[model samples]
Target: MTWLTALRALSAAATSENDLQQVLDLVADTARTLLGFDFCGVLTPDAAGESLVITGWSGLSALYVDRVNTDRPVRLDSGSPSSQAFHSGKPVAFRDITAEPEFTPWGGVAREQGYRAIVCVPLVAGDEILGTLNGYYSPVHTFTGYEIERLTLLANHAAIALTSAHRLDQLRQLNESLREQRDALTRSEQIHERLLGVTLRSGGLDGIAAVLAELIGRPVLIDDSRNVVLAKAGNDGELPDAAWRAAANIAAPQSSAPVPVGSAADPTRRFSVAIAKLSDDVAARIWFPARDTDLDPVAVRAVEHASIVISLELLRIGTAVEVEHRLRGELLADLLGSGAVISEQVLQRAHRLGHDLSRPHVAIVGALSVSGEPAETRLYQRSLSLVGDLVAPYQPRPLAAMHRGNIVTLWPITDESHESGSAAADLVQRAIGAVSRTVDATVAVSAQAADTATSYGEVYRTAKGALDIAVRAGRTNTVVELGDLGVLGLLLQLEDPAQLVAFARRTLGPVLDYDDLHHTDLVQTLRTYFASRHDRNRAAGRLHIHPNTVTQRLRRIEQLCSADLADPAVTLQFSAALTVQDVASLN
Candidate 1:
């Protein structure tokens, strides 16, 4: 082809093609055809601008290309004609590679490739040199001025084509980015509209979860503030415990963005979590596990919309709970008051709250046994949730209320024929133990189950009295009842403090006086001895002493008090006196 026709072909290729590789290939072919060279190649600088890399070539041996690339880069300061032309911004020619001293460094390579002469022209645009276009000749031939001029013009066109290819690449990338952003905006709008429709239709948390699962094409779960699973959908039983724990940890922080869990590169082990805040300091969290973990931007937007709907549902449920708790607290306060009766209105209200008043019910009052520290608001809320969860499996649907610095619960007895108050009290203590485990507090319960309205009021008083006795007796995180107290309960009910003190001094005064005079612990030894049911080995274990030491303390106690060693009445009297002493000291 003529130079004019070659130039025209180069322009058409540059304007029509987008791939840089194809453009470079066309430049190499055109340079070889119009310039009448055996081989032609295009070289571009590497990222560090250190050397020219052979990016495109035509009719060149693989061995020559390997030598030019791997053996050594064509550096700007190297003796290679291409490097020389690129650095100097001009055409460089070696008339005879075998004899020319200027071609000494690359002469051996050209001779091995069967080329006796070579010419290299710099591909220049404005003042910047882009690369070098090289041509090889098999026999020695001097390049004419006309030939050099034509080659230079062709090199200039190659530079323009390369520059156009670079600009086209940048424009293509920018267009892709704009398209992605527009698609994302459209997806976000669709999710917003769907969630808004769900809200307008009063679709609850279950509906919201169903919608989210459908949108993300993954399993969805919503957890309340207490970590109780409120709603779950589309989980095919493939989720593990670790996934749930990871979701909980992510949802603990109130972030608006979806926090990804597990290895992000491995979709089977990855998921996401988001939180939605509710009223009354409650929060609902949405979890998207790795059923279909390749969630796109649209799925993420659906999770956000699901979170909003969950927040609204949680607020609605929390408001209703608050109203119910308030009404239950009012009813409990009236029922426990003096001269209160179980009237028709009270029974109807109890039924509304899912409690049966006609059945035998256990009245339980619980208090934390810490001195001078009332429960914080957060602890109270946690305790309420825990108690509700604990009572859910039991019968008669217990009513729990926080009343006057205590947690009061009314649990019904299902079996009237074989009503066991002890079993009911055990359950109450177990429930309180669970609450204490969650709240970092030692809670004690006083329980009394009865069948009559008058008996409920009396049991309430009895439970209160038992609680006071348990606190003073150094019991914590346990259940206390009137039957367990024995004589101590009767003594606690005694109206006069002076008489109670007199009863204590009369039964155990000698041992107390001996301990006071000699600085011994005879009174404590007697108290522990009776607490362990007079078992010397068990008492020794409690006192962290040898069993023989307990025997010695008991002998000393009997000698000091001059009391009989084997009298049931004396043991009972002395135990009651010790309890009375403890109660007096607590006051």
Candidate 2:
């Protein structure tokens, strides 16, 4: 066949043949038949890109193919002609194989195969050198310019065909991947719809757990912060006690490490805990059996989605509770802030709210020492819950409200005239004990109980003043009465915050400035030191550092501010400034 006729035939076959190997084989056969070469071979790089392998061959002997294939992979070394052409992206020709110095070892093998001259044309696609098309001549022959051009054209065609086949394979893989993603998304959507349906139809956590158990093919258990199981589903005879106990010890929701309680070799009897937090106060865990569960990406994604739905449900419950609490808070505020005119309408409204205005009552105010909005909110909620339990003992049901980050309560005095004085002091002492169990705070109560004749507004103001005194006297988390705050009480009477702030700035400004410039905790250290009654050991323990460190810091403070902490007068001034600073911070 003529070269043009051969080229036309190969182009037609390449258009029809989708098989990459068949196109390569056709290229080799055409090169041998149309170009009058003694032998032709098509070589391509292997998967690892480190070597070339003979993939197609035509007009070559069995011994040649066997010897080459037996060698398996031909490394891309400088001694090999195919590697030279492939790396250089240009044709490499040997006019006489025996005359080429690099062909000393392979020249004898070529002579045995009846080839003395050779040419290697790189099969290139863009910047990548895929392989080479090699032609051999028995008699010594120099490749002319015309022959080289024809051979280059044929190799270019082969490169285009190889690139097309590779792209076709990639397209097929992409289509398969897209199909898999669509199916996964559809499954997730179906799970979401089922969960929503269960939420609407059953309207309970147990029903949601049952639905999730059925969908995920595992037992599902939901628990509150106290580890009391609220709902359960698909519980077989086997109990996951180890996972359950571990989850109870977890203060915060997290993916905990697997807890092993069985014999070390018991592989089938293990569980992993993945938690889904529902709210700041509520959380749930999905205990998956390590042996039976796959824990694939899809399963993990489904668990995450279930956590979101559970959070929404918990938030819904909390919202309803807040609405009730808000009504109670509004009633409590009205009772405390209202005047002494005991109208019949006011008495009836107080009656429905479970408050008795006729009986003598002592007002108690509790303030937390923590900072930040979240911390304050947590303290407020926890304090409210504790107070509710504390006041159950005292009758004339306690009225409570969270006002300005303080839990204010009005406890009824059972014996109005005789026992109101001692009863108020006793109530204050009991409240301090209860508030300490959850968070650190200061508790104070009115010295005298008030009835309809005295009015709730006067009692509330007295209780508020006692609370302010308790905080400023550096007696936080302690119960105090109005008389206990001696000089600080007189100082707190000055309510102008600007005057208070200016006094604090003038007193502690040098120490604060030194702290800011040095990134030191001198302000906190100084406050703690003075609060500990100048006891270096107590302050050192609180700071969690050495006593020497505290002593050194105190000396630095004395030098920076030119104030001696040893002097009682100077210590009194610093304490007063700190009190003012603390009160201003709360505002």
Candidate 3:
């Protein structure tokens, strides 16, 4: 091709092709065709900008190229002709490579390739030197001024074409990036819309989980504030133990963004967690195992969107649950009321709540033990959820509610063998045990089953009373059932606790007031004397006091109460009052 035609072809190829390497190849071929050189090469800077690398070449032996690239690549400071042309932004010529001192480093390469002379022309784009376009001749031929001018002219045009190709490549990459971003935004929107639809349909947590799993192509799960599995999608069995441990390490992400459970590069780091805040004190976490690979940015955003959906779903479910909880509490109050009648309206409400109060059922009450610090309401709600979840399998649909500041479950009896109610209480105790991690808890099961709702009041009272006395009796993290305590059954049955407190205060008022004023253990002394079976010496040893000191305290106690410890009825009165005082003081 003519030089002009060759320039036209180079410009056309540069403008049309977006690939940088292909443009470089075309430039190499065109330079060879016009200059009548045996070999041509297009060189670009290596990554460090320290050397000229042969990015594209024509008619060069692979062994020569390989030796130069791997063993002795020309660096900018190497004082070589190509480096000098690149650094100086001018054309450089060596009339005879074999005699050129600067070509010594590349001597073996040139000899092997059989080149006698070479020219290095800098490819200048505007003010910047891109790299060197080199041509090789097999026989000695000193470049004349005319020949140098032609090479320079061709090199200038080649620079424009290469610059155009580089810019086109950039524009193409930018276009692809924008397309990817647009598609990602579109995908995120679709995922968000689908998750929102699940919420609007009241599809519940399971629905949200399923949608999240499908969008991310990974298994998903939701755990409650307690780290117990609340719902699962794309999986049916237990997750890795590392998941729960990792979950415990990171606080729930405050926003919808998902927090990764493990290190980004760690293969063991398998789960991503997002918190669905229900209240300040309670939240649900949505998790997806990374499995073999981490989620992409779009998938991570999808998880974030899923978290919002989950939070909304949890709120909706929470509101509905709150309403049902109030209704259940009201119904439980009615059923457990002292003289509650089993009306049809009540039965219908019970059925609506999925409870069969007419069946043989017994009341079980789980009470939160009094804490030194006051408990927050959200803690109570979370604890109740845990308790309900634990008993759900046994009760199918348990009639449970927070009534009178206690969780009451009227569990249906599958076997009235009496032991079954106790066995059920054991399971309830385990469930309540989970709550104890946050706050202490106690469970009490009634001794009898109520065949109808009318009888529910009595059965519930038995459980409630035992739970009350159990908590007062310093029972925690355990089950308390009817018939377990001897006098507790009698104490709660005969009188309301208020009545007993009053009776104790009246009988022990003088001695307690005296002991308070003097910082004396008059009550302890009297109780120790009675507990030692009326043996003064043994009582003194038990009280960690001298026997004569105990005698002196007992005489003072008699003087304060104006009653003799020797009288049987007087002893009974003091003993009963002390027992009531002891039980009342246990908590």
Model 2 agreement with the true structure over 535-585: per-residue lDDT tens digits: 999999999999999999999988987998889999988898887787555
Per-residue lDDT value at 202 in model 2: 48
* lDDT of candidate 3 at residue 313, scale 0 to 100: 80
Q: State in Å the error of residue 467, model 2.
A: 4.9
Which residue pairs in candidate 1 have backbone atoms (N, alpha carbon, C) closer than 3 angstroms, thus clashing?
A: none
Candidate 3 structure, TM-score to reference: 0.68
lDDT of each: 0.73, 0.71, 0.79
Alpha carbon lDDT at 15, candidate 1? 72
Number of clashing residue pairs, candidate 1? 0
Query: Comparing candidate 1 with candidate 3, which one achieves the higher lDDT?
Result: 3
Better of 2 and 3 by TM-score: 3
Indicate whether candidate 1 or candidate 2 has the larger lDDT. Answer: 1
The RMSD of every model to the true structure, in order and in angstroms, is 8.1, 11.3, 6.9
Which ten residues in a row are the worst by lDDT in model 1?
438-447
